[model samples]
Target chain A: MSETDLKLPLDAWHRAQGARMVSFARYEMPIQYEGIIAEHRWTRESAGLFDVSHMGQLVIAGRDAEWGLEALLPADLAILKDGRLRYSLLLREDAGIIDDLMVTRRGDHFYMVVNGATKHGDIDHMRTTLPSGVVLDHMTQQALLALQGPKAVDVMARVAPGAEELTFMTGGGFDIGGVRAWISRSGYTGEDGFEISVEARNVGDVAALLVAQPEVKPIGLGARDSLRLEAGLPLYGHDLDETTTPVEADLTFALSKRRRESGGFPGVQRILTELDKGPIRKRVGLFVEGRQPVREGALVVDAEGSEVGKVTSGGFSPTLERPIAMAYVPAAAAVPGTEILVEQRGKIFKAEVAQMPFVPHRYHRKGASA
Target chain B: MSVYFTKDHEWVRVDGDTGTVGITDYAQGQLGDIVFVEVPEAGRQVDKGGDSAVVESVKAASDIYAPVGGEVIEGNAALADEPSLVNTDPEGEGWFFKMRIADPSELDGLMDADAYRAFLADQ
Candidate 1:
């Protein structure tokens, strides 16, 4: 509630746009611009501009930068090429997930992007555990914006020609109208887009420029949540937490081959064990049968009405036009086509274990078939 | 035609034995982009202010209460696939159901258009 907690760089821009503001994760952000569903479909078809400046940005640099980072996360920082981004999770000593973050190698410095809610604790943990020579500098004044959709690349290409050549997970520094920004071809909505990190003072001008484009519409946090949910990506606090491991969260792909073999990252022993021996409960997608969409904290029950697991994130998927959810179910029941039941409001609704990405993901992976 | 409103936001326009029921504009605005509506089956007996149907939006679900006691004679099935009709026309084509009034005398207790308009202002 304190004013010193956090603020988005585009706070004034949001107010000018008649956005209905809401408090989220210590930062005051726009909850809706036009409306949730309108912005959601606009992003799916055209393009939606999102103000994601609430996310935490940090730079990890030192003579032994790669070596220092390996001690905290379970990803191989040394093997990551410059300008390439790798999705990773910070793990505790017991292999529990501390935070899911993105690590991008920018020459001698490693750029870390973490969830806004847990960034404070994550930075503190890293600073205390890092070696004496390493330094963790928080980029608190940097503003982040995501331009996402099928036409996102074209919109960016109009101003920054270098952006079209950037593949997914790659980023580079670019100058746009006297404003220097670090643009990365990455986003949470499963669409092909760029997350631009710019100085706080110039973020408003940059945002205004993007919104002026014919294909771009201002999106708020409401549509951002639905887009990610339809994409089957997990939200930090809801689908993942400190008690969940990378393996249990079904995020093993985040770990690279070199890191798995080197076994130098924190909690690698337990993580490897879970990898070898399958986790007890795995995150799986569910297709709810009835009109009633099961919400979070709903109990997953078996044939005889015995609790098996818990629902992490559940809602109606606007893209699929049906009710879909993500739940942690027993590994044995995690297979696609397996029958399950979700208990909500004392009634058990029939559900089926289905594949992730209830709607087919349309990421712009180079040479990959659509 | 006299329109009476339920505290649950449903409005009933009574014309002798037949009554047209639908959600108010305020209800539609609060629900936001309704994706699906579960209308009660025709011939189902519903009491006044009873849970009779459901209106689902992209974010959440809300149950619709019967504005006056009656037996549902017909329902708008077209809304199943095109629920946005409720947002476009909450009173006309978006009407949820038509009920045969159980007691015509109950209409006296309902609010008129002027009273319902005032009810919205207070909210």
Candidate 2:
């Protein structure tokens, strides 16, 4: 490890568990324990504990914090209810996405989680953009852990008791083994899970307690990437960037109906225009024909072999047992059944545009059928 | 028959003028799960250090380089369906291809088992 590389609170724990550590977002984090495929399968079948402390946790405080955040983000923060989380995007003035984040209305203040790679930039952007009264607090003292899978609720209930009552996208404070934690029933994987935020001092102990359960195993960044890719969730630096607008990224759902009509946020003109006429390019899922995985940066070509778009994220899905990718194709070629050719290493492979979340999302929403 | 290794972690078991090629156990361990393997067709001429095959894991794809100049005799057919065989038994059943050595002198330039083990330690 380099002198500049940061270490997580569970860095020692991960190394002790035989994790292969790699430099990610300036942190020497675990990329895998036993293996990526095994870990990915275990998370889908049961429960997996992930150390995601590298993600930035921030709190937006002060009197008009909601309205202050609304000026910068396209989402309608005022309509966001207390204890509820909304997936929102931080946008540039030109309608490009700065970063995709999760914002939860925590009664008095808004708690937000941003991607680790862009967290510093996100904090700086918010600090400069928001009014003087609105305060941005980088919660560097906290560490985030995700307990994800189908049996995640069972495991959470076993440890934290009242955490089972918190449905998908809802978060509240809880006590786990005398350590206070903010637990949310949400995760990047398309499974029913929870993301727990605790003090850096208590994270190691909390992680150890969770992994002790038979259902939960320590998962690494390798499985986390594959799981989210299979879930059709976009990684920030890869699938999303400053040049890609929310509309082009197929994340128009993040823009509330009220926000769309009111037209207050940045890039409203370009965003509303795209919303009306549709974006020139669209992000869509791909089903590769052969077993050979078409990786990111592979070109998407049209019938005449002309370059149309590029794949953003691609990987072999452990759950589906095939190669899957997400790419931005021209709007006309973005249909679910449209045929497209992917070029990689001077070879052209057949692929078809498919609907996202290749595996259906199994969020544990309240009053929903299991 | 004697086995030779390359600095890139490719191995070749030499039998007269013919040799069977596969990656070393160390390389397979680093690759984690082997999802797919694409080998060069039979009869294709391969130069020393040339790209011979493609090995893919769930996370990334890597190119397998030819350890020595040879004429491809046969690509492993079993790996088309059972790529993980490379992970299970990399040196034996996981052999990627068989080739006819173009120049036997190339084998003299390759590393022996002891030298290869020492090379791995340096890495």
Candidate 3:
């Protein structure tokens, strides 16, 4: 729409492939290609390439970059080693979450990836909180591509052999078709995949090279939402917000053990109290009984038809072949297999608090049973 | 036999007292990858244009309207588990349901194949 609205490096290529595109987070993005279910299953079984260049990438460089970031976020960034990625949560003064982001340590600089929709606010918060010496450089010239699914490793090996040695949640620089790029073995799809940060100029060519592989198909936001939902990952504006705390969102594990003990991060008082006293409500997984799906903002009721909680996210889980959802319910009712009711329209449907993910996550981690 | 269509994208074929009902191919294309079909129960009375069934896809849900006044006699039960059939063969195995005609004159208000094609172009 506007000149400032970001476009992915493969925008034209996506349109040429008959992708149905829409404006999401100020970027023209493909909602689906071929079909949502087909692309979804392809990502699970083979590979799917996604244009995530819309997400904001910034580099915070300074003499005390880790400590500078720790002053704003609720995680102990000092423990984060170079090349390793750590999930961190930005918090407001009231202990509520501002945004959840990935922080990567690169020498004296911390590479940060924040949600596309909240990038501007997150940058402002970082600039205002961190000292003047810390420079927040937004990498708007870079295009991020996510090559996800089981076959991603082999696809990456063909272009950048150095990518194979990089373990999960680690990133490094390498040559991708002679174009230098930052590649990470991390993704949001709950599958083994890689996220490549390439220069905007060469993004289209590199994406074409990757998608040309027989196993690599182009996916869109429709499947991306279902995949993340099945994986039990939180969507920023929906499942998390400024009023929800990291502990209440079930993301307390993102805080390192040393940070938990030291309690020096933002909103540490309320967060540590919630961690010890337990949150009043907790986010839980819901397995619907029938084919009828429940959606967001639906009322969650107890057995007596009394409203107790609300569904934050719900949909038909393609991987599970049944409908599943996530809701924030009373901690007493958040146990696995606890029965809850979801009301859509005027009818009430039966649902259970099932163990997440609705489908098992296949993250590439060391000592994994897979 | 004369084939007619409703503005809601439902097609009906009429011959004497019997008429067949199905969604148009254009409607199926718009509702990508139909995953669930809620067919009207047999023995239910229907109107010339009313909600008769529902088709759910990964993206959205659509209501199927009856093209002619009739009482449902049989439904395509195969679609309950395999709704994608609607995408593959919307006019054949994907037919929603068959009904006994309650009023044959209701077909006169519906559009024929040529008019329906013209109507789609305007859309």
Candidate 4:
């Protein structure tokens, strides 16, 4: 680890488990334990534990907090029900993405989680924009862990009996092993899982308890990236940046109906215009023809070999047993079955635009079968 | 026949004027979960230390350099279907390609097994 690289609360434990550590978001994080592919498969088949403590957790409280937050984000936070989580994007003045985040209403206050790499900037941006009455508290003493997979609910039920009651995108405070924790039935992987927030000091006990289950193993960042990629969820720095808008990034679903109608948020004109007319370039999924993985930054080309766009995320999907990628392309070429080419390392391969979540999501929504 | 290693962790086994090449075990270990391998086509001439092949893991891709100048003879066809063979049996069935050695003197500068182990230790 470098001198400036911070370590997670479970850093020592990860090293003890023989995790390959890498620098991510200024933190020395475990990239893989057994291996990326194996861990990814395990997460899909069984439960895999992830240490996501680097993500920034914040609490926004005080009167008019929701309205204050509404000005900077596209989501209608005022209508968000208590104990429900909604994925939202922090937008800049020009409607470009500042960062994508999760905001959960906790009755009187809002609990928000932002990407690790952009948390500090996000905090600064919020602090500067929000009214003086609203308070922003960065929850530095909390550690977040994700227990994700098909068996995740079973494992969570085994430890915290009533945790299974919380459906997808729902969270509430619960007690596990006598430790106070806030858990949400949500995850980046397209699986039924829970993200638990615990006190930093007691996080190790919670992690130990979860991994002790026969169905659970410690997964690392490598599998996390591949899992999200396979699920068609975009990484912030790679798929989303300050240069891209939510409409262009295929995240217009996060724009609430009320927000779309009233249009009070920053860059509302541009966003509403793009939403109505459609973006010039849109994010789309590419299914490569062969075994070769077309990685990020590879050029998307037309039949004439003219560059149209660039790949943002690409990898071999263990589930699909082929190479898959997500990239931005001209609106005309964004339709499924549109043939395109990916150029990488001086080699060109045929690719086709496909609908995403390349794998179906298994979220345990309310009233849905387990 | 003798096996020689390069500082970049590739190995070449010389049998007469033909040298069979593949990445070292350490190289495969460093690159977890080999997903794809791109090899130079047969009849292509390569220079010493030039990019000879490409190995891709789920996370990143790396170039496999030619330890010495040679003309490609054949690439392992099995890798196109199962690249993990490079991780499972890196030295035996996983050999990447066979090349016709350009100059016999190039082998003299390569490392023996003992020297290669020492080089790894130094790293």
Candidate 5:
């Protein structure tokens, strides 16, 4: 928010496009381009391009990069094939989440994208713990863009003719709009989409190429948040934090079978024990019953009005036309049909514990139709 | 018969001792797509410049302070279903509530249309 805020690669471009810039992770980013609700609906029905260059992209390589990473993360990196991406989490010694990230193996090196706010801390943690044989390079000069939605594949096809061939969670290098980029069929919006990584200097061409397509419009962080919230994806700072564990966050799926059995990672024992016995508190989705939106810092109160849990991420879901939220409640109150009492600013609301992915995911799978 | 505005962007349309209050069009435009509004109910008493109503956009929630002290006469129930009216017709149908003006002298401390326009420009 200050004048000292670092500029994104597309800072001038965003300003030229009438985007409202806000400070995030020390970088000034576009919070909205046109309008949040309009851009949100547009992305749901069509295609939207997002400038996510703020997220840290790191390349890990050398002798034992795979083994070095597996020792720190919970995912089964041993089985991850080349040109594929797997969602994984870095854990603390107590099984608490350090950060949720994506790890992709591209030929000889593994590329990891971590949350922007925690990238420096994540890199520091890895550098101290990883074996000396492994090398981690922070690719600060690379800019990332995500083309997401129902028509994203079509838009991506037009940008890079062969990129659409890669299915969900897969990636490869491609020349997009004459600029070389590592394009992947992966995104945060729970839709058929692609994440493109290109040189910061060359990203303008790639962005122009994607947005030039009729289906694609430039989206912003504001819509990006609402889209992911509707997708039931937890944001790192808001939903997944240092005090929350993967099991408690209902992210046990990210803990691969091999890692669960071999127990080599940080806090492997604690995580496995919780997985078996069930965590005391569980992250649950809420279907807020009213039109008035309940926001973060709202308390989950019991009948007696005592605080039992807290809302982490809560907002109005543009697609659902109602308010929804995510909270960590007692395991007993985390059931699908349980009534959740949420209190905000002296007003109480009735919310129901609902299954996540509030909007049905439309990822383009191998055999299933998108 | 005339309107006075508060620095906070609320406008009070005064007619004798009764006043109708709501946020300004400029305020609504800045808020961008208000999804929810909590209007003051009848019989409620509010002080000038006190936080009174709640207006929430998709991105954030903002408080609409009372432009001047008053006793609430009627809440704008129409806003419950069509909150976007605040965006489309903020100075008209989007009026939040009708109130009995506590003191006509309170209007003397507020800005007229010309002064409010100058205030916005200064901002």
Candidate 6:
């Protein structure tokens, strides 16, 4: 581990639970406890509690907070109901993505969560672009945790009681064993879950309380990565960067209809044009024929052995029992069932373009009959 | 048959001119889960400490080098269908390959069971 790396509030608690910590986003975080596959299966079957404190949690408030945020992002904030969340992208002037984040309209302010590695740069960009009257507070004193999987709601019903009332993409405050936490009914995993925001000092107490239950086991980043990959979620700096546009990243749904017509957000002209005409290249999923995984930096090659595109995120999917990946290929090859060749480590593997969310997402959407 | 261990965590069991190779249990335990293993084909010549095969876990891939220079006679086909054998039984059925020992003096540089145990403890 690097000497300059930061430590999480539950660093000692992770060690006590036999977590094998690894460096991730400059933080010494747990990569696995028992093992990646076991933890992944446990999360799919039961519940897995994850420490996600490294991600940046910010509160944006001021007069016209919604208006200020709408200028920087593409979400239709005016129509977003209170207590509802929208996934959005921070865009550069020329239509490049600064970061992808989730924005929630609370009572008077907005709560935003961005990626860990790009938080500092995101803060700098927003500070410079936003108006002088607007306020952005980085909630560094808070710690975040996610309780995910099929049994997460069951665990929450016993601990927090009212968590079941909230559905996907919504959040509310609750008292969990006397600790006040802002619990959101959402997560990166395709399964149903909650993201709990609590005081940094009380994270250990919250973690201990949840794991003490029979259904919840403390998971690590290794399983977290595999779960998100199966969910087809793009990870910043891996599947997304400043050079990638939201349309090319297959995230045009983040651009609201009203905003597309109004054309006020950053890079609206280029983004709107691409949304109409279609991008030259698109991000798509890949299904490898063999057990060997093709990881990031592997090239998508053509029949003549020339590089066409690159693989972003890939691994052996414990859930699917096969290798899956995400890559950027020419728009003509982005359709499902189209074949592509991936070259890695001096060997070539035949792959096909497959629909994303390789495993079906089991999110508990509101009004969906169970 | 005599078994010898290398500092890189490979083991070679020798009987006359034939040698069976695999990683040690300690090495497999450190590598976590074994997802894939690629071994060289028969008749391929490998030098001592050269990259001869590959073993991939969920997190990353690692090279399994030849413990002693030899010509590969056979690869363990069982690993292709079930890679977890390396984690379950690394020194037994999980043996990666069999080769004809090209240099008998190369075995002298390896460690015996007692010395390997000491080396693992030091690590």
lDDT of each: 0.87, 0.94, 0.86, 0.93, 0.91, 0.93
Candidate fnat values, all: 0.30, 0.91, 0.35, 0.83, 0.74, 0.57
How well is each residue in A196-220 modelled by candidate 2, as lDDT tens digits?
A: 9999999999999999999999999
TM-score of 5: 0.98
Off by over 4 Å in 2: A1-3
Instruction: Please give the clash total of every predicted structure, in order.
Output: 0, 0, 0, 0, 0, 0
Query: Candidate 6: misplaced stretches above 4 Å?
Result: none
List candidate 3 segments past 4 Å from native: A1-6, A367-370, B15-20, B43-50, B65-74, B99-110
Tens-place lDDT per residue, model 5, A1-370, is 9888889898898898889899999899999877899999999999999999999999999879989999899888888999999999999999889999999999999999999999999999999999998999999999999999989988777778899898888999998888888999889887789999999999887787777799999998989989999999999988999899999999988989888888899988888889889999999999999798888889999999999998998889999999999999999998999998999999899999999999998887777755
Candidate 4 matches the true fold with a TM-score of 0.99
After TM-score superposition, what is the CA distance of residue B101 in candidate 3 from its true location, in Å?
Answer: 5.9
Q: Assign candidate 2 its CAPRI class.
A: high
Candidate 1 wrongly placed segments (more than 4 Å): A1-7, A290-292, A366-370, B6-8, B16-20, B40-52, B65-76, B97-123
Tens digits of lDDT, candidate 1, B1-123: 777876667888888789989998888987777877889999999988788888878777788988778899998988887888999999888999999989877767667778878878898
Which scores better on TM-score, 4 or 6? 4
Of the candidates numbered 3 and 6, which has the greater TM-score value? 6
- Give the higher-TM-score candidate: 1 or 3: 3
Q: Which candidate ranks first by DockQ, i.e. highest?
A: 2
Quote the TM-score that chain A achieves in each candidate. 0.97, 0.99, 0.96, 0.99, 0.99, 0.99
Which residue pairs in candidate 5 have backbone atoms (N, alpha carbon, C) closer than 3 angstroms, thus clashing?
none
Pitting candidate 2 against candidate 6, the one with the higher DockQ is 2
lDDT of 3 by residue, B1-123 (tens): 888898889988777787889998999877777777888889999887788988877756677889888899888888887888899999889989989998887888889999999999999
- The runs of at least 3 residues in candidate 4 whose Cα sits more than 4 Å from the true structure, single-residue gaps closed, are none
Model 6 C-alpha lDDT versus the unseen true structure: 0.93
lDDT of 1 by residue, A147-258 (tens): 9999998998886678867888899998765689999999989888889899999999899998999999999888898899888999999999988888889999987888
Computed on C-alphas against the true complex, the DockQ of each candidate is 0.37, 0.92, 0.49, 0.87, 0.83, 0.76
Worst 10 residues of 6 chain B by lDDT: B27-36
lDDT of 1 at A342: 89
